[model samples]
Target chain A: MLSSNPIKKSLNWLGRQLFNQENPAAFFDPLVTPINPLWIRGFTPAQVQDIITETADTKTFVLKPSNRWSGFEAGQHVNLSVDIDGVRYTRTFSLSSTPARWAEDGTITLTIKRLPGGLVTNWMHDNLKAGTVLGLSKAFGDFLVPTSVEPLLFIAGGSGITPILSLLETLEKDHYRAPVALLYFVRTQADVIGAERLYALRQRWPAFNLQVVHSQEDSKPVYLGEQHLDTIPGIKARLCYLCGPKGLMDLASDLLGKYGISDDRIRVTFFSAPAPVFTGESGGLVTFSRSGKEVEADDGKALLELAETAKLNPKYGCRMGICHQCKCTKTSGTVVNSLTGKVSSPGEEQIQLCISVPQGPVTIEL
Target chain B: MIKLTNEQLDALAKDLDAIRDEALADLGERDAKYIRKILRLHRTLEVGGRVMMPFGFIPPVFVAAVASLGLAKILENMEIGHNVMHGQYDWMNDPALNSQTYEWDTVCTSDSWRRTHNYEHHTYTNIIGKDRDYGYAVLRLSDDQKWHPAHSLQFINYILLTVFFQWGVGLHELETEKLRSREIRLRDKLPLIKEFFQKGGRQAFKDYVFFPLLTLPVAPIVLLGNAGANLIRNLWASTVIFCGHFTEQAETFTEEECEGESKGHWYLRQISGSSNFTGGLWVHILSGHLSHQIEHHVFPDIPAHRYREMAPKVQAICEKYGITYNTGSFGRQYMTVLRKIAHYSLPDRVRLKLQAA
Candidate 1:
């Protein structure tokens, strides 16, 4: 999007192509930007495991659909592109793996529940299997584990744990000796995705505490108010990391502020695309000098998001980057990473931008 | 020109529901009878070693076909929903068409939608103040008229806002418009309120909240397949719709012009509003029948199935009446529309944020 005229032209051309052909790969033109455009060729159902007991309708599928070699970020998703009869279609999904996880294995574990009137996801539950090849695109998001940020707090709800799981993996890799806490909310005990894993992680590292709160469950009535996550405890101090449905994240955020958590301490990842924040130029050159990416981020998205949308392939994690995969050395001017968070370092030439809002011609090193 | 009255609207709603039911029932009967032949064909294919997959998922070769089916189903729903909802309102004179039956079906008809979608949206487009889809400070679609200080000289702010908050803005605009409309009494609109409350009320409050929340976040497979089917059909049909309106060469009249135009001028305006795509095959299957946006804009009441036979006639009449007749290749026109929408957003990409102080 930063590179307007050409990107717009390309998108226009691709949009036209999509009109003619269902799930056209033309729309997934990676050459449009330096980023690796997520290409969904096809997929095979990998594993189906039950997550929650709500009708057991929600099952997580470890998909290895035909054709596609999954390339994803922890919080990014794949668009299931399928064609039925003669019509073609595409749907977006948030990936549950970090790039490292995806690079090693071409498997995307999609935590799916039967949607009431959903199109592709509904078909996935009813018909998909090991050999069932569904259309899939490569990793198309910037959400992943932030690298080595202090006192990281991960707050999640329901099946929203997929991205957080990837973050947990990255945190383990960086081996940061900071206190990392996870507050996962679900309807019941069964809804917690990696409760045992986190428990083990908690046991291994006293700095890491795993707390699971179920709003609907009578037995473990932790975090009683289903309406507001702000009602939780110890939300301040820690650099908050959030991945779940929007409402939960919003509630977490609203509560964080209420409990005296500054906007600087909190980060949220929406289940769908979050609103656009100015990442500097409304339409101009965006140079991530260290990453060798100098392009126009004109399409009206966050510079990071534009980078992702145009497939810039920049290194970013936890899109909120409380983890700091989106951390960059701000060699020149300032960049707004988040709509609210700001970290000013005039001398060191570095900043974390999932919270750094963009202004003008800015340079960053990965 | 028939004046649109509330009684007429109610009557129209009833009639549209009846048309939908009758058409759906007829289509169902036809499908049942035709399905035997289709089954026979499938059986023949099966015997001949053709690959026939199950209802839900299938192999790769069929992926495109499956997507197409999904697109088709979606289009059929939209077409049936939209066309039966509006296009048939003029057919109240036909005694064969029944209204009482369809008025009460689930997926209640949106009178508000009729106002926004039928009356204003398509008619007003992106003319900011006039079109209720006005997005404030943060930019939404280029057509949203407001210019906030943050967006002045900061198009990325505008674009990001548009892409991210586009859906919300759309939904909000409808809700905002409906809320402000003063037409629907608060008590009578309670059913809708109740429906939304029942559907959207306790999203995380009630355990059932997961049902609708999961509708998108956790989309159900069966419903998705059906919706996929519906979406496929809709895509195919929507292609025609998007192409028809959003195509290139369609003049986007300014708010002053659009609002100021006379009824005759408005009639001519809608004529010049959209374009017709080319190719005899396209003319035959898509342009010829399934949709006639070009003709519909000129004479919205005329049935689309009658477009192919009537298009030349309509064009000739426009020529005689000194009204411009717009037509082009579908691909060409659609590309034009995209370019225009994109173009419209670029003019003030960087609005000056300060005075020369």
Candidate 2:
């Protein structure tokens, strides 16, 4: 038994070569496709094991991915592809489950907050269910906890508690020696996500502290301010982690700066891009030259969104302005970049379809 | 068809563009589902057909197996592979469905086809000297083409082309005409020739060697069945493609005529240069949705399944603009194409006006 088993290894290789000739990932398909075997190939497929309602507008999706899924880091994000009405939509979400949990149960969780009038999120909330198959990209992003054992402060707002939850659970499981405090803000008490888990963590870890702020319940909105920072002892020395809406994160950053908390000590993750300003003149025809298709442009919407509405599938990676994957040639007319608030000169120029809204009649070489 | 002024033609182009936009906007789950289902069915049929080929000891089994395999190849080459490789489903963001990355199960490399068909044929359409696909360098499709002594043998050439259509498509990018004229140096042709051989060798090995050899004692039967299947697929593909592009009603434009072409002129050229055939869903799929050739010429990147829904809308726009939408039954279209090919083989003056009428 102690000797190297050459025969076993050879047989394993032979078996793999014979069965996995067409697809290397076919073995994993059987594992996850017990309920639905008709999974899309050439993509990492995962089955929705369960859906847990975290709040009124938020739900945590538990996924059991194929064996091809390499384990993800605690604070990493993964791109998920879901098909709604036969059209596939991709969105990135931070994995909220600990690596230990994934190792033990082979499951991960993504807490999604439904955005009103949003395409993917609304479709997911309304239609996604147990046994539904989804495509997943390998884990990415570098928002991990530092090696230092300095006391930690985690500030989470609304649905921003996802990655923080992962970090806390990992720390608690590892028996972290440092003191940790969490300030979770939501509109009301009912809006709190993972309340029971946070309570359990507080009971188990002696140095762990939890503060659930119900902002809407009070006569005046209870925004995190200097007063909140003063309550946490030695807050200036703590390694601060912030994940929240842009407005809340901005306020916290200002306060933390005033408190003399160093820049390196603060880590922030944005769940979504800030809402784009819709100042471009619309109600003009947007023509796709190659497809010979034209649609009336609605005021203040990015060309990518308009393309989607027109049922012309334009390639895009990150919906935010950062990714240049959605760049297209504007053959004529001006387009305003919603992210930078810069207007393009009329005539031929490359514009990011995801960020550029039509100023007037536009023709795009899509 | 009523003659129209330049301004009226421009209005027609605008109306046709509007139709395309409306068609795109109307695309929904049904359109996506159609292609997805066809892909699955094609795959299933291919597997089933291949599996049944070894049992060709039974005469009925041999015919059924060959027919099934032939149909599978047709569907794959036309409905699934060709459409997918056109960047039709690129918006789906499924890497498997991406046009740039899709490799079809044919001798022709996807890269070469994309350049030859997607860029050259589609961009130039039926322009006499510009579009290689007008006669595929072997036939005199229009009177605009200089009549040659070699074109007298076009009747036989057309038959041979149909028999080996896939190989013709495979070697299309080689531009053998240029090679004959020494327009391309041998060094320039090296990479393309290497790619062609690589793809051709792989296809031959699979169809003629690997699968046939796997059948052992029934190897001959399997090999013959495979050959028969390929022949059927080739003939059908040739018929569908030829009918779409070379019918009597289809016109060829000169480079001078197409120069300084506005959007309206482009639309006019596409309408006159392409012919459509009326068919059911199965027929449409078998034709690779080339039945709606006019719509396809206008919108090459849109999913081919949407062409059926778009055809009537485009026709209505054409009617409003007094532009002729050249469409007919499958038999009518094929006969017309064959008649045109025969009629155009002779010198222009010698051709009968009665036949032209």
Candidate 3:
């Protein structure tokens, strides 16, 4: 609607001409940014209003996004970016608070758990405070509650309980009378995030069944099995939503398939990109997604050279990797960074084409 | 001409590489804060100037408006635009400061700049017929270029070039000389020509049309102020850049001699091809730290602000290798540049032996 409006369109064109920028806000952002970091354009800026320690390694960050931010659905995820040691790093996290909460108080929460070597999550835990501002992308994820008020089953592990908490809160607010069961998995009771809120919801909502399953009870870990699936009421009829580590998700999908639940009925969400195992070999069928061209790369040359050799003139500068002018999206396959010698995960990632050498077959959006 | 042996060149390379690494390692909060402060200052001046434009009927106010706008343009073009486009602060990961996508307030598109200045120029720095930036394919700086009767007025041409420096830089990628020689077809250059017009047209509209028209009865004064501001920025930017590389002591290299060059030899070439000038903090900032052009040539991707700390170490390495570290006061260096332009304007047969700079 805004795009079709003639006055707004002409104003946008005039702004572009006058400012020599993408928009007027960008041209003026630097002037007012020091007064309030939220004055920034392009990305939505959010201020940390509060922080709650959920576990030893996990914390819930309560953020108040600027009014320009379009709110999200209850069970969606957003990418949070933080500046660490002057370099910006980003990581994805599920919104732990419901949309109604944001509408009422202009605030949302993201529950994060620290990864062993994770740069962003660790920085958030150690450095982020009540007044720190961070960059946020709009919420995105298909892990949403079904509108049909049918029996629903939720399976969450570790920090994966985040989106599920938002879904549960929304369901209760809407007073949905349909049956619901949540099998929340954690290593131990101390590690259970939002423990009090889960128990509170179980007591207040009659149809909500909350099961806190401790996998590592008394140091003898008991994993998910058929007994857990068989005990859930109406397992065949209820639609399933899963969020967890890859191992748990695969196991759950396998058990649900065996129980006659179709693949379409079982939806799952992965919190982070799965790390790829490298064979330490060279040569891959490099696909340029845009051009639909395939190149058989044999030697251990950077992708930029290979692209140019195939007569594809991808934008590049400082061919040795210093200038990020050559950075492009590698949609799939692992690559080793020549400068830092770090292996990349086999998923979509921004990489400097001048430094990235494919470990095997890799696809890039040139 | 450089006389360093292979062993000496290797040691020089090691020393320069160590200096670059040390500066890069020290880049963190301090570097980020410094750049952000400059960005804020630039924005403040620009906003203040625009706000004052409507009241330009007053003589003092008009002068202040022009000066404010000029300083802002200089800061943006040199300190922020030039250095950021060099990929100096790519580690910051700020979208506005990103080298790949940042569009400066100038007429030249960032894409064209990245190709011409970053890739072609910086990579092949000062190698005749390779780095077009040697004299921007215009004035003949070194004797390597063939002398022509047209070069007789290159002294006057240099003055005109400085006054309209931004336009000259914006049109540098068109390879106008190649176009004249019919080496590149006009049909092939249609897309580039369109890009230049679009970018340059927007800049003209902004400074010449939009802002002036918005000021109603004070339109003429506002227009004059904007033109004056652009002139100041162009002259300042041109002078600072000329001092960086055009000093008499700077050497020119042959592309054939650079074939299969080792890392040490590459380092030697960079030092020989560039010159530096001494200045205080404000001068350094106004020049975008390009006054330390020798250190910048060694590590172009490193943050420009760090060049001050890196210069002494680079000079020490040059001294150790018996290399001439070309540096002098700003006035002295700029004088040598003017002398070189005048001296080179004549045929080599009639040229006088100027004292070593």
Chain A TM-score for each of the predictions: 0.54, 0.70, 0.88
**DockQ of candidate 1?**
0.02
Q: How accurate is candidate 2 locally (lDDT)?
A: 0.80
- lDDT tens digits by residue: candidate 3, B1-357: 577777887788778877876776788889988998999899899989989977888889988999999999999998999898887887677777777777888888878888888888777888999888888777898888889999999988898888988899988889988999999988987887899999999999888888988876888888999999999999998888888778988988898988887778878888888899998899999888888888878888888998888888888888888889999999999998898888888888767444332
Candidate 1, residue B53: CA error in Å?
36
- DockQ value of candidate 2: 0.29
Q: Model 1 over residues A255-327: C-alpha lDDT tens digits?
A: 7777677986676665632222335344456676665777665443465665565455655443432223343
Per-residue CA lDDT of model 2 for A1-366, tens digit only, reads 744588667655543332222343333332334445545345778889999999889999999998878889888899888876656666678899999999999999999988765667778899898988898889988778778788999999998899999999999888899889999999999999988888999999998989898889978888998778888999988999999998899999889999999787899987642222234456588999988888888878899998888788986654554224455767667788674466654544456788888977888987
Candidates' interface RMSDs, in order? Answer: 24.8, 9.0, 2.3
- Candidate 2 wrongly placed segments (more than 4 Å): A1-35, A38-40, A273-366, B1-3, B353-357
Q: Which RMSD values do the candidates have, in order?
A: 24.7, 7.7, 2.8
Which of the two candidates, 1 or 2, achieves a greater TM-score against the reference?
2
Q: B77, model 3: CA deviation in Å?
A: 0.6
The positional error of residue A11 in candidate 3, measured at the CA in angstroms, is: 2.3
Docking tier of model 2: it is acceptable
Steric clash pairs (candidate 2)? none
**Maximum-DockQ candidate:** 3
